[model samples]
Target: MDAVSDFDPARYLSDDLLERIRGRAAAVDAGNVFPDDDLAELRAAGYLAILVPRDLGGAGLSLAEASVLQQRLAGAAPATALAINMHLVWTGVAKVLADRGDDALRFVQEGAAAGEVFAFGISEAGNDLVLFGSDTAATPQPDGGYAFTGTKIFTSLAPVWDQLGLHGLDTTSEDAPRLVFGFVPRTDAVRTRDDWDTLGMRGTQSRTTELHDALAPANRVVRRLAPGPNPDPLVFGIFSVFELLLASVYTGIARRALDVAVETAHARTSKKTGRTYSQDPDIRWRIAEMALAYDGMLPQLEVIARAIDERADHGALWFAKLSGLKHRAVTSAKRVVDEAMLVAGGSSYFTRSELSRLYRDVLAGQFHPSDPESAHSTVAAAWLGPVDPA
Candidate 1:
């Protein structure tokens, strides 16, 4: 990886680089293949080390900068951006911990600088409790390590990941229950199934993973806390970084859709009026509406990301804000893509059109963590307290 004195995403993610990535996005999606070239170029440009601290031989960028960079990357190729988000999440979490004076994940920064690819192994089938619950079994060993046995779903970068950062429930200990968080290196014990066929973002290749006695050595065990919401830094770091980065990806999609809309409007002419669609009042209004929705998302992302980077305390409200930002970004991006499809006319209906690919890609955002229901619930709970059980 190339090393730079300062973190400037625009410097690395140039218009030329973006066009190169964008050029391959359609083929990647159609073939459902991982963008090896995109990954190689990004890694070579030093993007993989954006969140690692300067001392650890990384760009040492803040979450705010990372968020902006993710948006730019996503605009070029949402699938690639979404897939890389998993790796960045781990590095972002390490940054979060280090900023709070807990250097437990310092090795993560070191590993990232050394080009170790870390995959997120949190999502599981039928586990809606997200971060508060787990079905994976974490069997404690005599040497303070853990043998994890369970299935992890939507494990992005499955084909290339070197280590998986995952969490599981430890029910064997006398304490009975604790959420065990650790990093499991790829080995024969960990099997990644060749699955991940999807309607959109196919290039992510987020396949299912089966762990049979996967081991996380004692030193790699990062945290063991109660399996529920708490003031734990681990929980905060994961939620904050994951949600922000996820939001950034969708926001980028919206920006790209808006640009497509503008270009299509200017190029297409109305036979009836003998003028470009850009001058059509109705078309202009539609573009404005897309712009209106798209504009609000980035500011919110920047605010929340900067707050996290600055270690600003919002108390319990942080959860609501973070989830809300994600919920809004995805929803708004979907709206922008929808409008752009309309602006692009019949051409966008073709499966090969970039806007069509974007249309499908934006849909996956809703299924990610902090879905609409969960986001509403979180914000409502923050404002009105939990619903009355009675």
Candidate 2:
């Protein structure tokens, strides 16, 4: 048995569930369709409610377990994995709201138990995602409610969201821009198209949602003085777990690439040498290098996961470290995919080869929120103190 099979982070998901997810991804890859069946399989497998508290009739898996499932999911289909990433974020924030005595928490929790899905609405049309703030406006309503009027772009899974979080300027506040977090069900507003058809992660179906004169109760609104700062820092910061899982997914893809490369080398005959390509020392070195990379990522992920589990009170430093880890994970994925492509030679790009699929999926994380440049800058600033570039 391989190490990944032995690790088996998804004890909750039966063999039937795992196979079904893989099959769905395969079908989506072939047909270039939305992973509706994949999401349904996850919901049926109880992964959609993995983060909900046990008292709320959820599985209540730990961060480590969730990370494992996410890694496995990414290995199959990164676009689907990226889309569902919002669920983990929402679950973490929802838990924090519950601790703050917010009434919306229970409803969200209940919805999770019922397999209802929520998506994020952070990045807007003109909002500098790295800094924050969009043109979207949310005005406090007369009946102790709020009216959300804005267009949100890059809203992953918007077409299927049951609950969505909108980040807009709170008209009631005067000082520094107030980062208002408002929750609204998709059924409450009209959605428009952002129509994200990119070079990679094409199947994510990320689109824009426009909310005009949408009414939201006070209980559902979460006002944060600073973005990404939740009432419960510990729970919210655990998203680093996703980063570690992403590393595992990249490693798995690389490992598969190495396997195929070795098989092809042994089978294909070199014209000049009249011998197998595997006989060449350069080919052997690439295989060894790939193995070394996969081995290194696994332990690092475990170390970080254990740290978060042990120290629930990690502060800004934790956020910085999580950012750094995510950067490293994606960077590793980039290198692994690049190396796999080289090792596979021209065959990696062949339409029929599995390496072609893995290569495309691996590049998806290169530009995610956890991109290396921003993450490294955040970590460096934390370490060297914030720079005043006046």
Candidate 3:
């Protein structure tokens, strides 16, 4: 057994539930639709509020524990895990702030406990500024609340997100260019476009969301800060939790691919050698290589997650480390999937094969935030300073 199997951080998800999720994954992907059944089961299991405080009707699991659960959930159904991750990100941020004695996001925790699904509305089309800035327009009202009007892309959990945790630029206030982070309830002002046709992870239905002056009430308006990078806990919480959870999803894909490959090897017999592929040195070595790639990720994820849980204070280097971890997890998972496909042979080429789905799903990993380019940039700056401002 791998080290990951031995360490369990979250125990909310029963093995039977994961098996059911796995059973539905193929049909969900085949239909290019949301995993509604999976969502219902998870919500019923109290999985949605895993990060909210226990007193708030949640399990009150730490971020580290939630990371492990995401990995497990992703191993069964990446799309479902990915969609639910959006909600968890908000709740995780709330937990992180609460751990540090800040309760500004107590509403988020309470909402999660009350079964309100929160979706991430940060990504914008061609908006590389991600989290630091927003292309969305935020106008303040006399009552102190703000109305946001803009398009937010990749809005996961589209079919069911009760509120959107989004950011926009407030250019009308005395502060002029402050970034306003707030929540908008599902209202007439908010519209979701059913345009989530993608190569893989289709079950997520991560549609584009358009906001037409969607209102975030005064109490729900969370953070207000300057346009670019700040040391606020909300920023830190979002970045850290988002990156780690994303990494765990890809890592789970890697684990699933490797498992399928191993199973294929044992069951398949080689015509050339008149023996099982598991006995073939080449197959054994390939599986070993996949395992090796996967082995390194668990420790990094666990350590980083524990550091966040313990508030170890890595300081300025935190962003770089988080990005690097995500970068490696994605790239490594891709590599493992590639090798697993080769090991599984011709059957993996068919779209129906689990490995084929894994291959397609893994491709989506590189497209997420802290992508390869930005990740490398951050690491380079950490080591040699910011490219001499060239």
* TM-score of each model, in listed order: 0.97, 0.84, 0.97
lDDT of 2 by residue, 1-390 (tens): 122334555566566765676566655666555688878877887777887889997877555556666666665666677777677667654554454455455666778889988777766654545224557777777665667788877677766778886666674655545666667876556575757666556566777788886766787775544543444442343245445555555555555565667787688777888888778778778777777776676666666665655545556677677777666666676676777677778977875666777777777666556567678777888789888899
Show model 3 residue runs off by greater than 4 Å. Answer: 1-10
Question: Candidate 1: misplaced stretches above 4 Å?
Answer: 1-8
Tens digit of per-residue lDDT, candidate 3, span 194-312: 99999999998999999999999999888899988899999999999999999988999999999999999999998899999999999999999999999998999988988998998
Residue-pair clashes per candidate, as listed? 0, 1, 0
Which residue runs does candidate 2 get wrong by more than 4 Å? 1-10, 95-106, 129-132, 174-176, 226-279
Ranking, lDDT, top scorer first: 1, 3, 2
Give per-residue lDDT, candidate 2, residue 182.
66
Superior candidate under lDDT, 2 versus 3:
3
lDDT assessment of candidate 1: 0.92
Q: So what's the TM-score on candidate 3?
A: 0.97
Q: Model 2 Cα displacement at 80 (Å)?
A: 2.1
